[model samples]
Target: MNNIITIRFSALLILLVAALVTACKKGDNNALTPDLGTRVAGKYTYSELKTGGKTYPASDTNLKGTITLTRQTPTTVAIQLAIVHKATNEAFADDAAEDVDVVEAASGTIELHYNGDTIAKINGSKISIEGEDDAGTVFTLFATK
Candidate 1:
């Protein structure tokens, strides 16, 4: 009876130690902080737009007048485009603010994702977006505050 009790206690101690060790382990060093998103979130104007080997200036008459980046979480941001006719601005999503994931690839450099695919990147104060629209027109937008 004494031997069985000793063995059980030893097994329990080992299990507890393993669980604690795993729980105390640190995660990725490059993990983004909430403040980082806040620092990057703000209004930015369209500097340029490119598609099919043609470069054009982005204006209210041709494209989105401006874009606002709002922090949704430590790892995500909500991008809202300004509506010309709306009384108040809203998110890009039709129903809810669809958040785009923000990954800090390196210091001062960040990647943006939607639906698990990278669609944009932020370096310093500028944001460069490359993606397709609903009409299948691929475009790249460069904007800065």
Candidate 2:
């Protein structure tokens, strides 16, 4: 009777250990959702900029732009803008870049807002922002991861 009980207990213990080993993953668990800040923090390269009745493609000599995004809070992201879209000779001022709140619009889409305006969005590896200069010239910037 002792041998049978010991054998059953050892088998049960082995099964429990196997179950735990399989349940605990070594890295980030896909079942867990990442915070909004972490979900959108990354570097995005400019794809294009449209303004002044013209669209500047990334292939343009002076249209190259890259922005870095950092996690500020669970619902905010700080954007570092380094861009020179020569088509309109528009340069982002030092104070133009700001931290913005983010909201998950959909499963894979996150919208960025500033001063109650929707300024940008992160859709998977792509990001897009729209803004106007002092002169009221509206411009849209598109980038990708």
Candidate 3:
């Protein structure tokens, strides 16, 4: 009778252990969905190409003012660039809004695309964008949070 009771208790213990193991197993769906806008949305100090191997800050008289990024959608964002007069400290162009699609790659890199062309790639807190303006001149923008 004691042997029978011990056998039954061991079987129940084994079943409980198996159940707990199965319940504690991690699932493949534990990966988090990337939110690009929440990660990259902020005001950044903007810099761009000025001339041959030269760069200028956005506050420069020839360049625009600060660049602002706001989230429009899960995959899209709006850019607002301010153009100001340095001496007068007046904003001549307060709003130049442009929309671009943002993609978060599986490798944890963020890409900003305009008109189906990749304009920027962001890694960590640094962002670099390269594209051409309407005047057919190539420009590269670097920004940091």
Candidates in order have lDDT scores of 0.71, 0.80, 0.70
Candidate 3, superposed: residue stretches over 4 Å from native: 25-31, 47-51, 55-65, 83-86, 90-95, 104-109, 130-139
lDDT by residue for model 1 (14-70), tens: 999999998995877656544556766888777777788887765532555566788
Using all chains and alpha carbons, the TM-scores for the candidates as numbered come to: 0.56, 0.65, 0.60
The TM-score measured for candidate 1 stands at: 0.56
Q: Give me the candidate number with maximum lDDT.
A: 2
Runs with alpha carbons beyond 4 Å of true place in candidate 2: 1-31, 51-56, 85-99, 133-136
Which of 2 and 3 is ahead in TM-score?
2
Q: Candidate 2 lDDT, tens digit per residue, 27-97?
A: 86764888988888888888877888787777864666687888888888888877765577577622344
Which model, 1 or 3, shows the larger TM-score? 3
Best by TM-score: 2
- Ranked by TM-score, top first: 2, 3, 1
Determine which window of 10 residues in candidate 2 has minimal summed lDDT.
89-98
- Sequence-dependent TM-score of model 2: 0.65
Kindly give the stretch of ten consecutive residues in candidate 3 with the minimal lDDT sum: 58-67
Rank candidates, lDDT, best first. Answer: 2, 1, 3
User: Could you tell which candidate, 1 or 2, scores higher by TM-score?
Assistant: 2
